[model samples]
Target: MHNTALQSWGDSFRAFVHPRVITMLFMGLSAGIPILLIFSTLSIWLREAGVERSTVTYFSWAALGYSFKFVWAPLIDRLPFPVLYGLLGRRRSWLIIAQTGIIGAILWMGFTDPAQNLTMMAFAAVALGFASATQDIVIDAYRIEAADADLQAMMSSAYIGGYRIGMIVAGAGALTIAGLFEAEGSYEPMAWTVAYGCMALAMGIGVITTLIIGEPTVTRTDSKYFHETSDYVRFLLMFALTVIAFIAANIYTANLTNPLKSGLIDAGMISELAGFIAGTLKLAISVAAAILTAWLTTKVGVTPTGMVQETYIAPVKDFIDRYGKAAIVVLTLIGVYRIADIVMGVMANVFYTDLGFSKEEIATVSKTFGLFMTIAGSFLGGLLSVRYGVVRILFLGALLSAITNILFAIMAHLGPNTMMFAGVIAADNLSGGLATAAFIAYLSGLTNISFTAMQYAIFSSIMTLFPKILAGFSGTVVDSVGYSWFFIGTAIIGIPVLFLVVLAGRMMQINADKQAEIETKT
Candidate 1:
C-alpha cells in the first residue's frame, strides 16, 4: 500500500533535495530546450527575417507534433532500440536517440536561411518539433519509472523547475546571444545562425546527463507480441500504413473543403472561424480513416488487433468506465484549460517586437524576469492546493488566467512602456504558474494508477491539441482586428473556461463523496 499521509511543509520542501528529484530536473531541462526554439524564439527569428505574419503563424502548426505524440507513444514504450538497448537499457537508449535528433534538427534549423528558403526552414522546424516531442515522451516515462509514487509530487516540482530554467536558457539566453551578434538597426541571418548553433550546443547538457544516469530497474513480463521480432515488425508495418492513410485522408479532405472555406470567408464569415471549421472537419475525417485502416489490419492477424486494443482502446475504455457520462466534461476541461495562455503566448514575441521593444528588452523583461515570477507563482500554487484543495485552486487559476489577458490588452494600448511591460509580465507569469500547478495536480488525480503513464500521455495530448490549433491562427486574428482586440478576444474566450472549471469541480466533489460512501460500506 502507498502512504496517503500528507507531509508537513518542511518535509515537502526538503524532498526536492533527493537525488532522484535532482535527476528529473536535468531530464526536464533536456525536454524543455527545443520547445521555445520552435515557437516563441522561432517567431522572433521569422519576424526579423521579414517572414509574413500569417506565414509565421502557419509555422506554429509544426508543434502539432507534440499534440499528436500519443500516436507513436506505444512504440516508444514497447519497441526495443537495436544496439543501444543492449548497451544502455530501454529508457536511456531512447533518451540518447531523441537528444541526438534534437541536436541535429536544431543545427539544421541554424544553418537554413528562413527568408531565402522558407520551406527548408519549415522542414527543419517540423523535424525539431517531432524530435522534441519524442524526447518529451521518453522523459515523462523515465520520470515515472525512475521513482516511487510518494515522491512523484516532489519530482514533478523539480522537473518543472528544471524545465523553466531550460526555457530561460532557450528564451532569454538565445535572444541575448542573437542580439549580441547582430549590429543595431539591421537584421543579419548569420546572427540567428550563431544563436541557434549555441542552443544546439546547449543540448549537450541533456546528452551528458543521459550518459551519466543509471536506468530504472523495470520488472519485465514476457509478452509474446513484444518479445517476438516478427510480431514487432508486423505491428510497425500496420502502424505505418495507418499513418499513411491518415495523411492521405487529411490531404483529400483539406483540398475538398478549401473551396467551401474560401467561399464562406469571401461571403463574410470570419476567416479564422472558417479555417477552424474546415480544419476540424479534416481532422475528423483523417481520424476516421486511420481507425478504419487499423480495423482492416485486425483482419489479417490477432497481434495487431491486440496491440491496438492494449495501446489505445483499453486506456480510453478504462477512463469511460471510471467517469461514465462525466468523462466528456473532464476531457473538455482538459482540452480548453490552457487556451488563454497558449493562444496568446504564441504571438507574444511578435507582439513585443511590433510594439518597438528590442530583442534585448523583450528578453530581459518577458523571458528572464518573467521566468522567476512564474516559478514564484508555481510555488504559491502548490502550497495553496495543500491548504485548500486542488479543485478550488484550479478554479482560482482559471479565473486569474482569464483576468490576466485584460492586462495584455491594457499594455497593447500603453505602447511599449517598459514599466507597463514589466507589470504585465509579473501578473501573467504568476497566474500562469499557479494555473499550471493546479492543472497538473488535477490531471494527476484523474489518472487510474493502472494506466498511469498512457492515460497521462493521452490527457496531455488532449490538453494541447485545441489550444495549438487555435494558436496557429493567432496572427490571422491579430491581422483581422489588431492586437488590442485580439487580446480582448482571448480574454473573452476564457470566460467559458471559468464556467467549465466550476462544473468540473462540482462533478469531482460528487464523485469523491460517492467514493467515500462506498469505502465506508466496505
Candidate 2:
C-alpha cells in the first residue's frame, strides 16, 4: 500500500481545488482588507501624520462597527433588496449593498486629510466600519451555507489563507507604497491619502466576485411575510429611525458645543453643565429610541393579523433555550479569549514605530512573513479541531496566546533586534492563527443553519466587542506604565481567560459526550 501520509496529503490538496473554494479565497481578501485599514493601517497613517498616540488609539473605535453588526444582522438575514434581491438573491444583494457602501466610505476616508480634518476622518472611519461589518455579516453567512462540513473546513482554510494574504498587502504593502511616496518628496499626510485611495480601488475584486457568484438558497422558518409589502415597511422603519437619531444627536451636540462652551470642554474633562446635560439627555434619548425602534419594527416586521414569530427573536430564543445559563459561560469566554492578543494589537504597530523600526522593516518582518506563519498555524489548528475537538484546540490557543505576551515583554527589553523580532513574531502569529481557527470552528458549530446569519453575527459581534473595549484603553496603559509594564499587564490579564477556556472546554465536552451516548442508545 502507498504511504498513508501521501494519501492524506492528496485528499487535503483535492479540497483546495474546488471552484467555490477558490471564490472564497478571493472573497476572504475582500473581507480582510477593510479591518486593517480601520485598525493598523490607519494607525500607521496617523503616526506618519503626527497624530497623537492616544487619539490614534481612540480612533480604533471605528472597528466598533464590527461589534454592533448584530444590531442590523436580522434585516440582512431576512430582508430582501427592493430590486437587487430579485437579480442577485439574498446574499449577493446584501453583499453588493455592503460593498458599494464600503467603497464609497473608503474613498471618503481617502479624500479627508486626517491631519487637517480629524473629525471628518473619524466619521468616515465609522461609515467604513459599519459598511465593512455589514459585508462581513453576509459574507460569513454565505461561507457557512455554501457547503457541507468537510468543505467548510476547506473553505475556512482558504478564506484564512486569503485573509492573511490580504492583511499582508494592506499592512505591509500599503506601508511600503507610502514609504516610496515619502521618498518621492511627498509629505506624510498626502502620502497616506494616496495609499487609502488605492485600498478603496482594491474593493473591486469583491464587487466582481459578487456579480459572478451564485447565492446559496437559505432555508427559513418564516416563508410568509407580514404582508405582501411588509418587508419594505420594516426596512423603511429601520432607515428612518436611524436617520432621525443621527440628526437629533447632531443637532443636540452642535447646540451644546457652540454656546461659547469654552474651547470644547478642555480635551477630556466635561466642566460645563451644558456639556453634561447634552450627554445625559443623549444617553436617555438613545435608550428611548431603541425601545421605540423595537416596537415599530416589530409591528412592521411581524404579522399584524395573526400570531407571528420574528426572524431575530426566535434565533436568540433558540440559543438561550439550548444553552440555558451555560450560554453566559460561552459568551463570556468568547469575549475574553482574544483580549490579550487584541488589546496588545492596538499598541503593537505603535510599539514597532516607536522602537525605531522603519515601515519597510515592519512590512517585511511583522507583516509579510507574519502572514505566512498565521496561515500555516490556522490550517494546522483547523485540522487539529477536526481530528480532536474545538474545545481542546480552543483551550490550547488561549494558553498559548497568553504566553506569547511574555515573549513581547521580553522583546520590549531586548529592543529593536530583527533576529529576536522574527522569532517572537513567528510564535505570536502562529498561536494567534491557531486560536482564530479554533474559535471560528466553535462558532460555526454553535450556529443553527436556519438562522446562521443572525446567530453567527451575534457570536462574532460579542467576540470582538469586549476586546475592543479593553483595547481602547491600551494607549492609556502604555502612556502611564510604559510599554514593558503594559505588556506584562496584558500578559497577566490572560490568566483569567485561561481558566475560563478550560472550564468551557470541559463543560462542552461533557455535553457532547452525553449527547453522543444518547444518540448511540437511540
Q: Candidate 2, after superposition: displacement of residue 308 in Å?
A: 9.6
User: Against the true structure, candidate 1 has what lDDT?
Assistant: 0.83
Highest-scoring model, lDDT: 1
TM-score of 1: 0.82
lDDT of 2 at 349: 90
**Root-mean-square deviation per candidate:** 4.4, 6.1
* Per-residue C-alpha lDDT of model 1 across residues 1-522, encoded as one tens digit per residue: 111345577766665677887887788788888999999999999999999999999988898878788888777776878889999998889889999999999999999989899999999999999999989888877776776554555566667777898888888789999999999878899999999999999999999999999998756433335767787888888889999999999888877789878988999988877888877888889999998888888887735666777767777898888776678899999999999999999999999999999989997999789988987787667666654566677888888988999898899888889999999999999999888877876777776544545677898989988898889889988998999999998888888988888887677667667778989999
> What is the Cα root-mean-square deviation between model 1 and the actual structure?
4.4
Candidate 1 residue pairs in clash (backbone atoms < 3 Å) = none
Indicate the TM-score of model 2.
Answer: 0.78
What tens digits encode model 2's per-residue C-alpha lDDT throughout 228-341?
A: 575557555665676476447656665545553445455454443445545556556665666566566557753342222456577888887766566788889878888999
Model 1 is weakest, by summed lDDT over 10 consecutive residues, at: 1-10
- Candidate lDDT (C-alpha), each: 0.83, 0.77
Clashes of each: 0, 0
